[model samples]
Target chain A: MSVTYAAVQWNRQKKLYDSVIAGGVALYLGRFVGVGAMVHPQATAETLLIRGLGTAAFLLLHVVLSIGPLTRLDRRFLPLLYNRRHLGVTMFTLALGHGVFSLVQFHALGDVPPLVSLLTAPARFEQLGLAALTILFLMAATSHDFWLKLLTPPGWKRLHMLVYLAYALLVAHVSLGALQSERNPLFVGVVLTGACVVLGLHVAAWGAGRGYVEVCEVERIGENRAVLLKLGDEKIAVFRHGGKVSAISNVCAHQGGPLSEGKIVDGCVTCPWHGYQYLPETGASPPPFTEKVAVYETKVEGGKVLVSRCAKTSSI
Target chain B: MQWAEGLTTMLGVYGAAGAVFAALFLWKGVAHVDAGARGAGIGFRAVIAAGCVALWPLLAAKWVRR
Candidate 1:
């Protein structure tokens, strides 16, 4: 979408999204710390802060994990997908804060150094927490488009997929660390509910059938709009424009964004995430840009649109 | 315990080297490799510095290749 890459392509919607995130985090942390201090007067400020941040981060992760399936299940959730990275980076920041506070509180001031102490900690939960934090740090660091360019979409996607592993580690970390120590049945119920929601939504979305043999009728696709089809493992975007239909890979060349969510603009399919464009017929960006996506063969039979299982590159 | 100590030492050295590499990369090397970084502002460079520190080895290879 941009000839030059900036730190972030800030827009009105992004600013609003970030503002809401900041306000929500502030409110959550304030309420959590305040209520904890009032209830547990013996708890130190650092302890309350650590608990608040850790809980906030865990809750945010649930929201982040839920956004993908929610968007797939209903297009109305697409707005949440646009600013999901901001939520992720925010979650990582809070987790980092929690980790730093815990390290300083527990590991520091001992004869052993903090890093070594953390690594050699007797508890398996500590090790799991450290591993999860390290993965989160890597993900937050490489969340930029610069890294996305360096690591191609597939590679970048694979790396980000490590978030699921991080989530698993954090779940084990919390279960072993907090659940073992706390007798609160509410904590157990909350963790179980969060995990089940995340898992359940993903299963439901998968069962919603992204892959369809017959996508839909040609008339079902609005002009300049696309209907997403997953044939086998390949996701294809079938676009209708000017009385003709064309199909291309649903994955955007930039950041692996869902191109099916984008609309045709200026005779080119414009990616909804960052507005990256590709010609519908050729699946190639216009001159001066060298991005290309796989074009799929689509046929209209009996007014139904059927996309090919195989992919092919087309001449521009 | 020994592996943990070894890891700590390796990470210390890597962190030291990465800090130095990140400073230089943010100062002069960034513009040479990414055309988009040319004439970019301090905010952009500052934001990228975090990744630069973590990924200094890869960036160093890229810098050398460039």
Candidate 2:
């Protein structure tokens, strides 16, 4: 949102967000490593480091992925959406630590070069882990808004969708790599449950609003204001602007900000998250900006607003 | 080891070329696009160029498109 960026735009809210993140990591690591030591007294420091960081990173990834759908389902989670890049960068650091220590512990000190051994590793899970790490590195490297501005919002969002691919690879990495040899059934259950929860939350969020549904009264949608209506599994912003109602995807193109919560300013629907603006009718941003969101078909019937599942444009 | 060594050497060469390509991209290429990175200062651009060096293929594709 700036011509030039600071190292970080820190504020009181960000301080609180980062504090919660750091504290959560510390607590999760302490419990995991402490319990691991008690369960396997013979485990080495390298083993503990690998497991602890891996678990922490995986858990954080789940939370990061869930935040998007969670905010769509309920706007209370919007604050978490504001600084999700920090969460992603932190998760990448943890995953990188896990990867490095794992390579040192298992791949190094062998006849072959560590890099070669890692690449040529016969282990199926190891290959998946490497693929996941590559995606994570790409995501972390471009987490800055500079990339978003350069790539354009749509391109940037498409590239960031690789996170889902990374998640799938990491799931394989865990189930095949760690769970295969895990003695504790509790650890296995925890890993499976984590995967299931992520999948279930996404599916549930996707199914929230789909078909034609009555949203709210036309009078309720005040001028220059928006009313969020659920359809299938997504939220749509039903806007009342210039004496007409237009519906667009509630998720902002830039970082999935809640557009329903945003106010129409200067004849454009302004996103509350990063101030990215879009035309209420077409969902396209003002000229010189190419960002857009899915526009839904809306028709008023008997003083009630109804939205169709079919998008106005195939591309949002 | 031999395969890894050869690949590393190739990447090292490519990395050097990528640095130059990224600089050219930032200076000449980005200026043309209306939505491209116009306001990014030298320091930020350098970091992006370094990223291009490490991830040459992806950045090169994006740079070409831009």
Candidate 3:
């Protein structure tokens, strides 16, 4: 949304979102540690903190993962998608805290160095945790637009897709590390439920996206607005602008943001995530910017907007 | 044991180098390559510096070319 990037393009919504995140994290950690102290008087503060942070991070990761599919299912969740990276960075910080605390408590006092001890630890769970942490670090480090621009949208997306791998690793890390010692059925059930919810939502969203080429009645699309369509694996945005209907790949050239969620501004399709704009007809950014997205052929027949699955042309 | 020691030493060297490079990059080199970084506040530079620590080599290459 900015010609020049600052630390963040801070807005009222982002400030509120960050405040909520900070408050929620503080409350979760305080309540968790306090309750643990009362429940297990013998447990050390470090142990409680490690457990609290680990669980909080795990829970936040679920929320972060769910936002994508949730937004796809309903536009109401778009606000959550807007500041999702902050959630991710916060989750990484929590995970890093858990890792550091666990390392200091279990590995630091030993003769071997902590990193070496971690890698050499007999429990494969610790190694899995380390692997997941590394992936999270990579993601957190590159969360900024600087890296996105440097890596390009597709490459950056590919790197971030390793989150799925991190998620799987963390699941194994928790199951093999904590679940082995804590044979509590409730804990197991909660973990299973979180995983299932994430998986089920993704599957449901995929199903919902299918067969959207016959998008909707042309009248349903408002002027200067768009309707999202998914033909096979491609997400296309059909826009009604200037009394002409045009279709373009919904993915933005910058950061792969959903263009369909955005509206036309200055005669260009402005991305909702960031204000990256593209001419609706050509799917190319305005002059002085070189970015382009794939354009698709669209037609109005029987008052329904139909989009071609194959791109008419791609200048990406 | 030897490999771990070697890795630890290599990482230490890399970390030391990265820290130095990151400090200098934040001080001067960042603005040279990225126009957005010019006149940006310390917070922005700090974030960029964090990335610079890990990606100093790449940033260094860009700096040299610039």
Candidate 4:
């Protein structure tokens, strides 16, 4: 099983169940109960639509985007990924609601201007929403274990990084959409800040330059293959063969994830994050059109490993 | 078509939120999610299902209710 730990954690089944329950609740509230009588009764169609969209968006963002960090926070969260599709599907569903309600209220059979405005007024901000939505749609459309089996974990994860892009766009989407409406300055600000914080945490992990802990010692490594050197920052494993030792941030570029936890497969080190394969020698990915990570220069001195942190690299 | 458009749209987006959460909770683990301590760490969230039920309406009312 790609989920190496699923058998051990049987706890994942519960999360899966919980997702169903949550969806049921949303349905019950929005449809069964309607959130209409008790609240939003006199709401502008715009308000109901926006509010619904916002709630859905907020839920998906918190659940999906928070995984990488939460994993670091706790390893048990690993099960989250095993069934990540379930979560992604949930997010997409919510986002769909947000979008539809938006269309209905703001543009559903409305006069030309509202329609045009839905497309135009929120263009700048909606552009971000569009970007995030587009990516989310692609991901959701492709989020089957079938595709996961078809595409390598690396490929899957690389595609998933668009989550960051989606997130950035979403922050902009909400910031401007909510802000302009001045719906609730403090509330919008708080949500926006929270969204930024979630996204920033992921960026910070990338900035930390994780994975591939670098240890540079020129003489021993010799050029055949680069062995990893554990650094305070990361546990990098590199290989130098055919005149170039590829270097990626010691962290798995796929998830800003750790690589040390991964295994060596087919002359490449598989990333622990999502089992992405990197040629330690070239830091290049295996197939199709994946991007390569930064390569570093190493000089060996009596077993002392030295690497020039500032090195450039090309993609696959 | 209205129902299709609205229902499809709503399911497609708003319904997605939980699925997304489920993904991260499965993949990312939780804050303070130590392998040895996972049971306790996430159980807290499991319990929050109720809190969330409450929190959701509260948040919806506060922000999106309009």
> Which candidate should be chosen as best, given DockQ against the real structure?
1
Model 4 bad stretches (over 4 Å)? A1-41, A44-50, A72-76, A111-117, A120-128, A148-159, A207-280, A283-302, A305-316, B1-66
Winning model by TM-score: 3
lDDT of 3 by residue, B1-55 (tens): 6776787789889989999999999899877877867777887877666677878
Which residue segments of model 1 deviate by more than 4 Å?
A213-292, A295-316
- The parts of candidate 2 lying over 4 Å away from their true place are A212-294, A299-305, A308-316, B1-9, B15-50, B56-66
Error of 2 at A193 (Å): 0.9
Q: After superposition, how far is residue A24 of candidate 1 from its true place, in Å?
A: 0.8
lDDT of 4 by residue, A61-138 (tens): 777777777665545878775666666766776787777667666565754433344545535776567568778876
Error of 1 at A282 (Å): 12
Per model, kept true contacts as a fraction are 0.49, 0.15, 0.40, 0.00
Classify candidate 1 by CAPRI docking class: medium
Can you give the lDDT of residue A257 in candidate 1? 92
**What TM-score does model 1 achieve against the real structure?**
0.78
DockQ winner between 1 and 2, please give it: 1
> What lDDT tens digits, residue by residue, belong to model 1 across residues A50-98?
9999999999999999999997787799999998889999999999999
In angstroms, give how far residue A131 of model 3 lies from its true place.
Answer: 1.2
Please identify model 3 stretches exceeding 4 Å from their true place. A213-246, A249-291, A296-305, A308-316
The complex in candidate 1 yields a DockQ of 0.60
